[model samples]
Target: MNPSNQSPNHTAEDESQAVVTRRIQRLSLHLMAISAQNYDLCIVSCSSRGKLEVDKAQLSRYMRGKHREIQERVFEYFNSRPDLQTPVEILKDDHRELCWRQLLGLVREAGIKPFKYVAEDPAQYFAIAEAVGSVDMSLGIKMGVQYSLWGGSVINLGTKKHRDKYYDGIDNLDYPGCFAMTELHHGSNVQGLQTVATFDPIKDEFIINTPNDGAIKWWIGNAAVHGKFATVFAKLMLPTHDSKGYSDMGVHAFIVPIRDMKTHQTLPGIEIHDCGHKVGLNGVDNGALRFCSVRIPRDNLLNRFGDVSRDGKYTSSLPTINKRFAATLGELVGGRVGLAYSSVGVLKIAATIAIRYSLLRQQFGPPRKPEVSILDYQSQQHKLMPMLASTYAFHFATANLVEKYSEMKKTHDEQLVGDVHALSAGLKSYVTSYTAKSLSVCREACGGHGYAAVNRFGSLRNDHDIFQTFEGDNTVLLQQVAGDLLKQYKEKFQGGPLTVTWNYLRESMNAYLSQPNPVTARWEGEEHLRDPKFQLDAFRYRTSRLLQSVAVRLRKHSKTLGSFGAWNRCLNHLLTLAESHIESVILAKFIEAVQNCPDPSSRAALKLVCDLYALNRIWNDIGTYRNVDYVAPNKAKAIHKLTEYLSFQVRNIAGELIDAFDLPDYVTRAPIARQSDAYAYYTQIVGF
Candidate 1:
């Protein structure tokens, strides 16, 4: 819009509304000139110059789900504050300081108290976390460390005494703390940690110590500089009845003071070292810590599962150490849940940027005609359309996860807890791995422009790379999912009722235990391939077959090798099985979302994207389907064609699809992702 044409009262919101108005006008004019058959082609042509018409408000409402208002508030909060946005090429220390300030800004300025909401309102807290992550992941991690990890550990594991004494300070950031869990030698294997905390009966304190170099707490955020205290996880030791030595209990968490609050110096018995500059997320000051007999009162123990008396005798209701350990870690699964939620938001940013850029970037086309959008090219669509589809799929899946977690919190049902834990683990692994890989694909799709630091793909990719490693490594997490599935598989035979997540297993196993009928296997109609039922069934068949086959393989191998060796031999198959199960879960949730969508237009759009996601996944793994004769060659070809067809359908509405993400231009911080006037915005930002 021309500056001269604007009224004196014009605001940024007004200009944004004008852009949408102009795009819709353009779309309406083009639609009037085209027939139904040429509608998609017309959209492809019009998109180079203008946006396509979509019910963006309705779609955005649906995509944002229950937390739309909170998310929008966060996005607007950051969008209005230029100071909060990290400048390109800032020093590491400056970046870390910025992250800390940004987090504080969200609390003091935006009034987003994720720490309080962690227990009071989990959904809202995660919504805030995701929005913050979308704008700046450094801030996201910093917030997670302070609220979700450190503060959450105290709330979930510590009792009323801990909450009364510490909750107010942690909430106000007066007592900055870190979650000290991972050690130099322990990343995923928390049980193998070597740090020891022996109860001192004489002093009525727990003496924390790092027995060896490998036992030092490593990669602890908020430790090197900002943290004053730490929720240290160490093996609890009690004096044996003979008084000759100490008996080791399992891992336990204690509130150990790491630095003096007033002096801002490391405590006498504590040592801290900066982990140095990292490949990404340098805004977070990762650090390592070692304790030389750090002592804290016996009351410092987070004794929800176990505790020691003043005399140093330990007592717990849980009979076994393994149960105590499981219970301890289960309470801390919120980290994985938050990561899965935030990872989806990060993927949304990447998708919106890349897809919008593709629409703006015109390139080679047919002879004697104007250059066409790269998005119109079949190859480009192939690269990005399914990615867009999967983003939506993951959104709904994660939303369901968030809902389940909230439900578990309210009920504390044992089965519900296990379901939430397993679901979070699987989704975190699958989604982060996909998002990490997709960032590179997105960067490459944007060509050299993506490589430029100003575009943000570099920073986004770098910061998100660690997500797959932290919150439990992807490989280890997936193995846990597979193990959970195998347990349910065993229960199915014993006539035991399945949990809500794996309830379909009983029927699916019975049906898929036999081969699919010849007629159904060979059917190749577009309607058949696109059917949600058929897609879900295909996914279920793969998961069920893998479960059965892997079970047989494990049992056969157990004769020659012990159970551990058998599991090691079948690790690859187990990972695949776990991935298949997660894929099925995602598809099922996507279908449920489409079925329940209130707006017809939004539902139709979602159905198209769902088809693309389902068919793309099926086509990618066609080899397995073909091997079992589950889908004949002709049917497989049909699935491929329909997948491509659905991609084109999605490409027609790609603008609306991305807009539904509802990220402001400032939040994306990419010139190429501007909603309107791409050339003008790009040139102005680039000083061309």
Candidate 2:
């Protein structure tokens, strides 16, 4: 049967394609709508329903003509908001709540709904967001809960039947739940979890219990207040076997209900506590949980990938227990993607604030003389423009990554899975960490007023910092990617041709021994980095070589020490290598996407931004690139010139830069970002 003809509930190829296409269209429209509302600094553009004629031609021109104009339009749009004109103090307390509320309103107003069971109807959930043209699911999920009045639910990865039975309920939000895995003392180490689930064959139940205080689940979102059910991970044991015979059969997942809806109280043997007042994401209601001899039906065991029979026989689809655990850990890739998208959203907000403020606020000129916009200053440009460039780089990379994620979801191939996992881990680490750091830099660029709550920069920075830790700690995530690279390196050298290994050995040695090459003095105006074919090849080669070198070293090192020992010994270096590799990929992806864009001006500006991004990295890692012959001394000079040129070009387009973000007025209305016209009105009202 044609996949398209299949029911929306089933896997249909045609349906998937249609869904993807529609999403692209919706996203384009949303971008266009935002562009129209933000084109002029004087007019306020609010809701999606606002009647504004988006000049496709002008937009096309802006995209093709000059990069700075794109920056300018973005700033101009953000500058029109009055609420953005308010101080930060008044905004912080309400920021999360307001964002949450606005998101909920958007869902209802747009008639969009979230899937009740994400695992079962993941496509539906993906489609809804694609249709809305927003990637931040946190807002959508929060709103979906309020509109549906259905509590959140958890998806089981252990068994297919578990998914079949409970997934529908979850997809509909009929039973909102939490996935409980991490123990208080054994985070990221699933094999070390102490919570146990012993089979009671006679009773056909599994007795779940936390053996000690350390066995209690911590950092479980929706556990403290919202969740009624949980997909609990526990160590499986058989009590009938003598003292020495009770073996830990690795971590297993079971669907267990924790609270009774009627009384709104914890069920027997279940305890929960709120994690109260976090640094951010307060709306999530995170908390800890414990189970004392909680009995659940044997059928509750989530055994899609592994299972236990009612008679107490254990079985698994995969032979290796570690692989099973790894499979479960892989589920967090979705969260990582979500995190990357959120980082982009936060970056957009930061860029909007910085760019708008740069264009609107002026200082340090003669009295009664026309003051220059702060953006015109080389110092200010250096501070915010690189970040602006980063925003575009992040945007392009995220879009491509998300598309790849969806494609991989279709086949469930292990290689695809591993790739997605690796990429997500790296991108999440890079984007969140950089966004957090860059947002603060942008805030500082705005001076004391930037610290004022009215500017939104401080709040945005705080909100984004959580991204670095959530899903997975950025440090830990990079380690995982590095580990994967190391594993690949070992495989390539161990059983493969010596030629491959030799090539890698040669490159690594060259990198270690080579001196800096003279920098290229080629001047192609601001479009040097925009040379479509050249940028593409450069990025591709750099990324491929970086990964190859790291993989080769990891492989070679494993020969001297055991896998685990080698990983531990070279851990720091691996992390550094992983970061370098990820950054290369990001730059490459950004350059690729921008070069392919139809607009010449947008391409040129994007090129400048790309150059800045690359140059900044080159400057930071001058020694490494110099040693490898990747960057010559003369090329270093080019890097500096590119940076200066980009800063200059971006200064003029500060207004337009903010426009590209397409934020509504309500979100950007902080006081310092307001335009001259609005400032006049505001000052008049204050009788200044």
Candidate 3:
């Protein structure tokens, strides 16, 4: 008998269901670990309770198991209490002092020790964030979101020791620190930074100065009002190496005190001012910083990777400056991953609101003049279900990526580290951009009410809009991934033996040219297109073929045109291919989990979700198929049929869909999404 056939002694289900149940339990455990890392103490506390209670019976009845319902109930219970809910309201009520106080409270709760003077221990901060679910980090990120646009870096990219010293008091709300790296003229090119740290051998100190206004740090988060210290990145100039020229001695980190604790005045060489507010995240006082002739102890330098001796000689364990810089860049990967998860959180909140509202708000049609819920409409299902599916997709993908990232860190695999970094950057760009767009669509799906601040969609949109640009702009990040892919293609193909690339090229060419393959249609029955596995395979094949074709085309183009020109010409196509690859990865992972679902009802619901995800992509890429001879007109008709079928299937599952999200009534705070009885009662009370 297959292992799946083995029955649990207590339950009467067959082996297949048992296996799926076990798989779900395993996956749930995995999710719990991720939640522990991503959520604060409050969130983790609630989620832990829910996880313990999730059961098959509950899962069958509601798309979400009992655990999810418990999670929702917990939210409802908490939000009903004035104290917890009051803080959220007050924080939103005032964007200044009250908000800061609330933020301080959250920071403390998030494990920042009170009365501390600095954030010298970055790991402790990360540990606290992990322990508390990063609520404070989110607040910090939100504060920096808008400010980052003007150029301040909120998340510090510094070593453990540097954080221990300069960041020590910040945890206790004592001495706040800002991250300063980008110069007015330098932007993303850290290599071109002109801030210099010269060795003063006589005094045994490092003299730090900005060569000009262009070299001044233009955008340092929390600099204008909050920060009293900074983690400054600069070029190290050796005293005796004057004749050797500035040979890229690698970027070194340093701690510089910039403000007087008692007077709150700028130190002798440091100047600061607030950056005026604009689009969003205006609460943070992002500002500019100028360093004149600031002198700090030689030991103030963060000497983890590179260090200077008292004699003014510089030495580094890493020989290559480029590799060292890349290593520094590597530290920012976590932020990118964090941003990806944050984007998912934003979407979750939006979907919860939209789904609940859809189930409550009623409109036209009559059964003895009864109003039908908006979710009853197929059009609404088409608009919202794909996004709902995508939330799960992103959730699963990010969880998996985080797992891979943790494993790589543990093993210290350089190649794995680089790959995760590149992948995280691309995925962050893809997920956040889509989530932002989807949230807008979900907002519109809610109609006029969605635009109201009280409805929460508008605020959610405003808050998430900045995610697209930060953690490196989406366009720039994706372009980097494309560049990496192109390099891989060249390395594999440009050499003497082109075995792998040639084989991929041949297979893709055959598929594109419409050569008949048995496996291609094996899964396609009269209703094959409707089969969830068939749809998944289609995404897989389509993505693989697209990537192969693009890689080959770029390679061929490189032979004739200059490398730069060829890359420029192929940029759009390459990025699209990467997007398709990512989509396929997400779809594949979602399908694997869905296939492992034990409850038949859940399997059915997830199947519809899977179909909706695939159909959405097909709709977006209809032109691609239309231009290709491989896809027949009949196949095009099949795509539309799949869309219509999935749309109807989604409508049937909308109530169940909302249940799967498990949003609490209080967090939603939308009258329409509340239970119908409550909605009616509230409407009456308000005289609506």
Candidate 4:
């Protein structure tokens, strides 16, 4: 917009904020020149007049060069694939079969197989798949089910024999598979499943059976038509010498061939039925299966941690039954981590659509003057800017998660594994929950136009809604995170420099114990918001206070209700505590990213985003902060104003901030957000 057309009410603060935006862009080239190791420490002195030195060359790379290449490849892959271009807005069972097969062919042509990623790096490959999700989450989920779930299980839970046997076909989509862990009677409670795998010594085989109707596997993706095999989770039933029973052995996975590859018919004793149309992502062939004594070779079991001897003895490398259970559960983190990564991908699409539309869309205006873009409106700014900030926050958090998981997968470090499990659980729940709320906001921000599928907002929303429940239910996952935090608190886990959660806890404890008046020493307003340590302290204090409150409540109630009863009663509060801890983790990552940018301009821009994230979160929970005496009413007011200031700072840089995400026009495809003149193309199509 022309500066002359600005409202007379526009003030000095708005102009200064605009300068901050330009100043941030100025350092981008210098930042790009800095080595990755020293990028974080890139600090430059202000000129005598306090103006930033502007450089036109592109220096700062928002993402790693390789990852940026990966993102562009995803956009290119979708745009160039004619098979995938067909609108899947609607499809019947038969059409879905064709769509699924077409999807397989397109992926093959793109060379985006799950096995290719598995061979390179499990964690990194999963992250890249998530990046691909911004275009089509259904395909992402289908691939996730094949590679991340089915292929993931083989790699993580199975031995070399299983990997060598299935990896080739899985990556090539030759031996398509389904992961059937969720039963009709059980979604979150795996141990409660009643499917039994009985050992038949005479036949030297394991008979997989559904003991009752409730044991049937429900929502098994790729089972309706595409999948020929399934990774089945069932109770390992063994003959007892005395009063011991089969349920005593717990759950184990078996490689069950569901359908005959040639006939495309269900194996004898296995009843399969389609789950039918879902709220969204109908492209996946989800089905249910009931096994009536379906027998398979004993060697079909994916034996890495556990095995059955020739003499019919069951033994495991894991120390205890719980450890065995946890080992299996731990391998599933790849999916959760990918879900979190994909949640950010989804958020980027929503923000891009909303922000670009608002910029071009003009509405009511001053008398005898040109109408203003909706983006100039405070309401639109308030709605879209914070969501944009959050998408960036999730991006950094996911990158951190990917690195941690990759490191853990390589070294098999127990501490890193435990941390990854705990982190993925909380991050997945938190990121998906935020994405759901933010996507709705983005949709509503676009007015009635957003409701139409052609705009892509409605479909994106529908497809992503399942993310809250799938992989793992967000609510149940948060509870597990709470349980983990409580365990960490009780154990008082020690933290070194790199240990995230425990390190935050340790700092909080030190502040409460060592510092007589930590709050008194705190800087006011922008100074406090800009300090990385201050943000960490704010997050840590809130988390610690909530954790302490939970401990007290549990202690008080447990005497009468018992530990289980107390825990059940306090689940809601525990969820909040976990939420606060996760917010802290996110803030810490954003801070790290902010501190590490070597270019002054780039660092300045990122700080604005990080500050906005921290301030907005703290503002939302101002009541909680006040209740704990963490912030005075006056201090809270300053924090609120700082959020507004940060919002304006972001407003000036909003276009460039999204440009940093680098989504091409081809992938977005919305006429309103087209790379060419969006208004001209839109008017040409609609004749408006």
- Each model's number of backbone clashes? 0, 67, 22, 8
**lDDT, candidates in the order shown:** 0.91, 0.63, 0.63, 0.79
Please give the TM-score that candidate 3 achieves against the real structure.
0.77
| Root-mean-square deviation per candidate | 13.3, 19.0, 16.3, 11.0
* TM accuracy, model 2: 0.76
Query: What tens digits encode model 4's per-residue C-alpha lDDT throughout 41-126?
Result: 32121112233232212322654434665656666776776556647355756546655655576467766555666546765576
- How well does candidate 1 match the true structure, expressed as C-alpha RMSD? 13.3
Per-residue lDDT of 1 in model 4: 61
Weakest ten-residue segment in model 4 by summed lDDT: 40-49
In candidate 1, where is summed lDDT lowest over 10 consecutive residues?
44-53
Which one wins by lDDT: 1 or 2? 1
lDDT of 1 by residue, 1-688 (tens): 6888878899879889999999999999776555334645645654453433568899888888778888888888887888888897899999999998888888888887788889978888899999888878988999999999999999999999999999989988888899999999998999999999999999999999999999999999999889998999999999887857889899999999888889998889888999999999998989999999888999999999998998777889899899999999999999999999899999999999999999999996544567889998779999999999999999999999999998887889999999999999999999999999999999999999999898899999999999999999999999999999999999999999888889889877889869788999999988888899999999999999999999999999999998999999999999999999999999999999999999888898898899999999999999999999999999999988878777877888999899988888888988888888866877887687
Error of 3 at 581 (Å): 1.6
- Tell me model 3's lDDT, rounded to 2 decimals: 0.63
lDDT, candidate 3, 1-688, per-residue tens: 5657655673546556989999999999887765445334433442342322233344444333222433343343334444433222334224434435544654454333422211232222222222212122235462332222111122234446544553435545565666677788886678888898887889988888999889888757667676777778898777555686545476777778889888888899888866666455545556788888899998877776677888767777778888777866675566677677667767776787788778778887433446767876667877887788788778767756665566665575766776787778778999999988988898898898777666666666775787787667888788877666555556544553223212333334344435434444333243666565556555545655666677777778889997777777788887786777677667766777677777676676676677777777776776775564334566766777667656655655566665665444555665556756656755654578
lDDT of 1 at 371: 80
TM-scores, all models, native as reference:
0.92, 0.76, 0.77, 0.88
